[model samples]
Target: MIEAVKIKTERLILRQWQDADRDPWRAMNADPEVMRYFPAPLTADESDALMTRCRDGIAQHGAGFWALERMQDGQFLGFVGLNCIGHDIAVKGQWEIGWRLARHAWGQGYATEAATASMAHGFGPMALPRIIAYTASTNLASMAVMQRIGMTHAAAEDFDHPLLPEGHPLRRHVVWEKIA
Candidate 1:
């Protein structure tokens, strides 16, 4: 088993989930604007279940979508880290870097800051050969973050997400990859 780890950046901390993170995480997940790129906002139960899985992944793999915290005030911002894609998507079975920040945390470069740290940890200590990031084709903000972190997009690597049904506006996904 991989040991639990925490990564720090110039302005953020990428660490494990905490008890106090629940409410803020729930609120972020429930925000329509925050979930706009996805299908829908997560309910309280859905948020809790996702947290449980994140925690479990951390316990089993030593890393997951880490709880992002601002270093200045120690406030819970959101999450940015690595996770394994369980489905047969373009990056299936690969470690994928992702991030989600509260609306208040937007436009501040926090996602990019935290994600840079996460990518370093994956490529350095984790010895991962590469990391992939993907999002709905319309999510320019997320795509920008991926680019800022040095991931490259290839049109041939794009694929329709299996979880999103046919005819869904967000079914088509663009994938970005960063090689070690």
Candidate 2:
């Protein structure tokens, strides 16, 4: 098995998911604002299952979406890490960097900070040639974060998300990439 991975930033710790994270994770998944870019808010069971999946992914690969914790108070802010693009999107099977922070954590630069560190981990230790990020075209916040972390828009690679039905408002996703 691969060794577990943990990344630390000045103000955040990107580490493996824990049982204590389940409740906050569920609340964040259920928050309308937090889930606004997705199809819908997840149910408690769905939230738990997702957390379990993240935990298992880390165990299997030594690196995956990790629970973001505040270094000062050790609060469960959300998650930020690297994931293999599972969908048959334009960059299928490529490594991707992603983050989802609780409402309170927004506008605090945490996402950018954590994402920068995650990207370094991917390029440095993981030796990935490049990493990609994608979000609904309307998700300006996430798009901005991607740009702030030095990813450039790969406009020609944009595609309608296969999982969403035709004409769905959030189906057309923008792609971005940063080469190592």
Candidate 3:
């Protein structure tokens, strides 16, 4: 069994994935607005596979995208945590922090709250020297979160996403980095 680790913030709890997360996660992945920065909403199988990857990462590394839960009501908000950038992008092989919240959870500063805790864990317990984040150039919301977490845009490090086709609208991505 995978041992679960939990990180608590004033308003949120970054904890391990549970079977209850499946339906909400799939719904979040299916929301067009939620997946707007990406190419398209994920299929159910794709979402399930992604969750599998998250579980595997936590099992191996003791940390990954911890399931974001609200402290007040124990509601599953989505996920926020540190992940290794496995893709062959500008930030490849580096630890990156990310978040995705359900539509109901937006506009409440939850992303910033959870991300702050994640960064603390990464830079503190993990002893990571630096953390990086990247998103589609047009994703202003995520960019704002990166800034709130003290990540600065590395303009020179921006690159077209290697996984996207040359002409895709989301191909151009901007990178942000924070050094400990």
Q: Report the Cα lDDT for residue 111, model 1.
A: 94
Which candidate's TM-score is highest? 2
TM-score: model 1 vs. ground truth: 0.95
- Please give, for residues 18-62, the per-residue lDDT of candidate 2 as tens digits: 899999999999999999999999999999988988888889889
Provide the lDDT at 137 for model 1. Answer: 98
Steric collisions counted per model: 0, 0, 0
On lDDT, who's better, 2 or 3?
2
lDDT agreement of model 2 with the native: 0.93
lDDT of 1 by residue, 11-65 (tens): 8888889989999999999999999999999999999999888877887889889
* Candidate 1: segments with Cα more than 4 A from true spot: none
Q: What is the lDDT of every predicted structure here? A: 0.91, 0.93, 0.91
* Superior candidate under TM-score, 1 versus 2: 2
Worst 10 residues of 1 by lDDT: 84-93
As a whole number from 0 to 100, the lDDT of residue 77 in candidate 1 is 91
Q: On a 0 to 1 TM-score scale, where does candidate 3 land against the true structure?
A: 0.96
Regions of candidate 2 where Cα sits further than 4 Å from its true position: none
Residue 121 of model 3 has an lDDT of 87
